[model samples]
Target: MESNQEVQISTNAIISFTDSYTQNKQRKEKELLEFESKSARAIISFTDSYAQNKQRKQNEQQESESTLSLAQVTSRLESLSNQIQYNNGCKLVIQIPKLLQSLIALVTFRIGTHLKQEIDLQRIEVRRQSRWCLSSIQVYGDEQIQSELVRQGYGRVMSITLSKAGGIDEEQDEEIYNGLRSISRFLRGLHAGRNNDYQPSFQPLPLLARRSIEQLEEEGANEEIEAQMNNRYNGLIKVWANDAKDMILNCFIYRRRR
Candidate 1:
């Protein structure tokens, strides 16, 4: 009986040792699995951060390049605009009738006086044929002077003809003749004083003989008739000259190549 008991006790002790070993193996495997999961999560997080940083750098580089390109384009446009504005290739043809030489001289004088610059008469080409005159001139001075002339109704650009090479096209002989015809017609109408016909009738002052007692007493009979005539004539001359100046300046001048 003692021998049988000893064998059973040894068998029980072996079974308990096997169970402890199994439990330890299972616990180690669980810990290993958790470690692997944490490593995988860390790797994924690192990769995502790297990708975001690279993308942000690329976007910044593209924005910088775009800004540089826009600046270059703007600078080029301003340079081109300045070049075009001051270009000297442009010319003008002004037509005036032979009968209005004095008017043309007056207009030229006024232009010089107002602009504070002498008229370059050598640059002007005068062609007198039959009954009319043609004055061809080159466009000079800065944009300010050109703009001022336009504002004052001195220059009317009838047409702009471009050259084959993108410069000003030379003026044609036919254009000069056409301009003369137009000017002649305008001058004819103006000289006839058709616009004066539309003016309101002038109200004459009451004669001294027909004046009221109070008026006669206030204004003496010895009032100088010559002085009154002179004043009236001067006023009329001023008004008429201004009207004529505007009419002449407002005429169309053809722009063409030199």
Candidate 2:
């Protein structure tokens, strides 16, 4: 009876050990599956975020390229030239130089070739060592004549005076200013490349005018004439002798024929 009771106890102990081992193996397997599932989820979430960021960047780049293309198209369209009729009047466009600070430009639209009306350019300012308020209309003549005068160095630009009243509309003033500025720039370029060898066809002034100019030069009383002589026609005496000076002085003193 004692041997039989010991065998039964040993058998019971072996069964309990087997049951515990099986329970531990199943728990470890479940934990491993849970950990693998979490790792896969994390990897998938990271991939999705990366793809979204890349796609968003590409979209922005495309949008920017489209905007640039549209701007270029608009610019090209605006630059297209339109036909202008001389009968209606010459549409003159003058580009002002950057050196001139105020009265952005002088322009005349629909100006007849023979027009000699005085123009009023409002908000004309000359910026030098000090700011000077200039006359609304600094110059007179049609677009063709004014353009020629400026081209030939016969324009009385330095003698412009400020007006007491009456000014053009703001929009017209701005347009004129722009045109004048453009012309200024063009004239500057032309002056820079002026042919020293090309002599202008000049007729001698009358005896009376020549005598007056000579007296003015001798006395040095006219500051404007002195300034013009010193600055604009430098080396005049050396190049063309006293005759050239007399000729230019005559142009300033006498009325120019159209």
Specify the highest-TM-score model's number. 2
Stretches off by above 4 angstroms in model 2 are 1-143, 147-154, 160-222, 227-244, 248-258
lDDT of each: 0.28, 0.30
lDDT of 2 by residue, 107-132 (tens): 11111222122211211211110111
Q: For each candidate, what TM-score against the reference?
A: 0.17, 0.18
Q: What tens-digit string does per-residue lDDT give for candidate 1 at 31-116?
A: 55765676577886756655665565455434533432423322332332232233321121111112122212222221111111
| Weakest 10 consecutive residues of candidate 1 by summed lDDT | 159-168
Candidate number of the best lDDT: 2
Candidate 1's error at 151, in angstroms? 99
Candidate 1 global Cα RMSD: 43.1
Q: Considering only N, C-alpha and C atoms within 3 Å, which residue pairs clash in candidate 1? A: 169-257
Instruction: List where candidate 1 sits over 4 angstroms from the true fold.
Output: 43-258
